[model samples]
Target chain A: MDDLPSLPAKLARLRHAHPGDFNLSRIDPAAQPCSRGGKAADKVRVEELAVELDGLQNRFWADRRHRLLVVLQGSDTSGKDGTVRGVFGRMSPLGVHVVSWKAPLGPERERDFLWRIHAQMPGNGEITVFNRSHYEDVLVPVVEGDLRGKALQRRYRQINDFEQMLTETGTVIVKFMLHISREEQRVRLQERLDDPEKAWKFDPKDLEVREHWDDYQRAYRDAISATGTRWAPWHVVPADSKTHRNLMVATVLKATLQSLDLRFPPLPKGLAGVRVK
Target chain B: MDDLPSLPAKLARLRHAHPGDFNLSRIDPAAQPCSRGGKAADKVRVEELAVELDGLQNRFWADRRHRLLVVLQGSDTSGKDGTVRGVFGRMSPLGVHVVSWKAPLGPERERDFLWRIHAQMPGNGEITVFNRSHYEDVLVPVVEGDLRGKALQRRYRQINDFEQMLTETGTVIVKFMLHISREEQRVRLQERLDDPEKAWKFDPKDLEVREHWDDYQRAYRDAISATGTRWAPWHVVPADSKTHRNLMVATVLKATLQSLDLRFPPLPKGLAGVRVK
Candidate 1:
């Protein structure tokens, strides 16, 4: 990847667009499109970027002008948790929040799909990361054949409108799809089974979902094509290499924060030299 | 203070229950009733207790059988935020959540006060800390004369019944009233004005409320007496000394967690010796 151009320009190449020509199978999940160099170099760069991002986050929190919402959507074992720890872990807990979306229960199920999601949106000066977000509504339903045709299209439209409204009200949105190959997932799943420490993370239900891999890929592609609007575009990240995945996310996030031009508010009047005593 | 007895026994002295003789003017805000020793000793003990509490929180999260809700209510500069940081900050953010309540805005005002609060209640295996809580309904409204007579009594009854339902459903509630002297608040508020970094936290409306200090104090006393139940007892914490305040809160919390007898859930059958691979 070229380092001379603006970060957004570099990232735009990986963003999913041109729906007519979009095909999930064409993108190689093992590709390192965003890598600065070798795995060692990429890992170092991720750490550097994480630090830079943390500085931006401090300014963003002090700026109190914009809300940032990051939505991470991917297949099971696609590195959502890893991405959060790598990219957002450096930020202050006071300013950054993570909401891991699980299956709706009780009252949440009674409301609209977006109800709970809307409630968790980032407030001004805050950043909220959604792990497996509202996008799940479109993917799981389509894969399970619960939603089809017009109903699915309506949900896509609803998400687009909702996101547009959020953007219009000063929320900066970034959506990432962590794409990993089926073979890579198999190795990870096996590793989870082999490591006692990782066993707790391996849900048996993941295997059931793996059986519908093709359907899920199709569902993901369709949903991304429909809902990847200008306001909230989706970046399909090739995530087979955990280091590369972290690097790419941290890079895109740093670029996003830079674009905001965050700055701290001016000190209150007459407090420049005021003594606490 | 003696350290020989169990932790709960030491903390029992701070838990308020006598509604008939409950007087806001009687409790000394500067008293260190729950402190283990001098300021330096209490600070170290607070740190020790915080780590201990973190261990218990891990077990609590893994247990997934009980829910914990911590309510922190106090006047301005009463150290609600400090309590969260000093007491619960060491715990994993995954298991601990903080909801800093502000004045009702938009649709929150449309519904009853408890509606928003009820929505934020902890799910199983989670601990939620409410910086300011549902008790605000009684204090703010009563001080402003919007709630009084039979209407106010009804709200107290409603709160009692609501808490009873939560306790029946396996939620353990701990309420803390951070009592700070009026002079101490004035000093803290002035410090905020003097320090540029803390200026943002200094809301001008705080001065407006400070003018109603006596009314708010009476309101707090009334609310605490009415809503404090056996299931959700209120502990009046002397918060003039930040270290002492943290120590008392942590000591009370440590005792509360111990009382629950938190334990990790049993591993899945066949997984005790099963290889992950």
Candidate 2:
């Protein structure tokens, strides 16, 4: 962790902006680049940031000028739910909405890929979190070999265009790809099986998907390389340690919200002096 | 507090099934029929129930057998958002989804009221909360005089049929009307104006609606009477005290979930002996 930069600088370093020559393997998932101290200290910092986020979220909700869309993408057991609870849970449910995308059903499959996604976008002054997002369209098909060559490239371009359009509007998009090592995933999957309460989360299909781990990684790298734009850049979060994962996500989110300079809408004229009787 | 019944009994007493001559004014908004103790103790219990709700939610999501839909209807400043935070916040965001309904927009206005609502229903094993729900169509229209006489009656019948069909198809519906007095609403609305942070929540239109409070209350009584069914019951929750409100809602929800006999899907065949490696 010695060479790790400041939080903002580390965010910059981890961001996937322009395409080409991006390697997912080079990044260490266990690295604590955003850690302010050891486990106990980081836990406290995460709690502090969560409180601060709750305050900012209230103001942001009141501002009504900007909309925030946070996208969390990762492999099975990559901590998407954990990240949401740790980072975004402090905000009032009125302000923050979470959409956990699953496989398309009848009506959804009939429409284009982005149709369902467009319907779930945040309204003015709302923050929306997508658990597994549109990126899954690019990742799943590619790894399953159902989409390839020019077709796959076309989808990536489509996603980039869609995100660019959203950003051009009032939406601020923050995407995080929770990076975890295969060994860590193994442990998590095993724990799911070993713990009776978690048994239902252990899907047999997840094992089938794990067999294509390398292919999925390659797909993720290529997808990120192709679509990560300045408008909706992707942040690679090292998530081996659950505490550090929460810490890194909280740090990045705080910085993004701070940069927005959120403020409550000015009181209506003469409203302050008006009394409610 | 001594008069407070057991959670299950309280839930039964609060439920308005087969509603007939149900008087909204008869229910005291300041009643603490669900409170276990004073404000501080009730607050602690609310927190505890929230955590338990979180655990049950995990199993519910994993169970994937039933869909839960919670509809919260109240006049403005009746604490819809507050109840969500105080009661539902502890759950993992992945399992609980909240859809706060606003006035019909362009496309929504083009469609029938239930069209937009049907599109947002929870899938199997998921819990969906509607902050302000399809019931708004009945209240707003009736109060505005746009829908009345036979037309309003027809809509209520339509809603009953819709809800019955949902329940028949494995959805468990719980509806709550957050009952607050006009004086309480006035105080709450005033607090919103005085607190700069809360000013955004205070819409001028709410004041206008308050002028028609009696009409809205009558509309609510009629609507709830027409639509309350054995399959989908409505609960009148005294919501003037925020702590008691949360307690009541949480208690009802916890009882509802418990009644389902929610359990994790039986361990997949021989999965207990299966190794990740």
Among all candidates shown, the one with the greatest DockQ:
2
* CA lDDT scores, all candidates in order: 0.81, 0.87
**Model 2 per-residue lDDT tens digits across residues B1-277:** 1122344675565677774767777788999998877899999999999989888888898889999999999999898999988888877767678889989999999989999999989999889999999999999989898999999889988998999899889999999999999999989889888888777777777878889999999999998888777778889999999999999999988878887778887668878778997
lDDT of 1 by residue, A1-277 (tens): 1121346565565776433335767778998877867888888888888778878887898789999999999998999977876777655455677788998999999999999999999889988989899999998888998999999989888998999899999998888999999888888887777665465577777878999989999998898888777678788889999998898888878877887777756556655554332
Candidates' TM-scores? 0.77, 0.92
Candidate 2: tens digits of C-alpha lDDT, residues A108-136: 99999999999999999899999999999
| Best candidate, lDDT | 2
* Residue B32 lDDT, candidate 2, scale 0-100: 92
Clashes of 1: 4
Worst 10 residues of 2 chain B by lDDT: B1-10
On the 0 to 100 scale, the lDDT of residue B229 in model 2 is 78
- Tens-digit per-residue lDDT, B133-153, candidate 1: 889999898999899999999
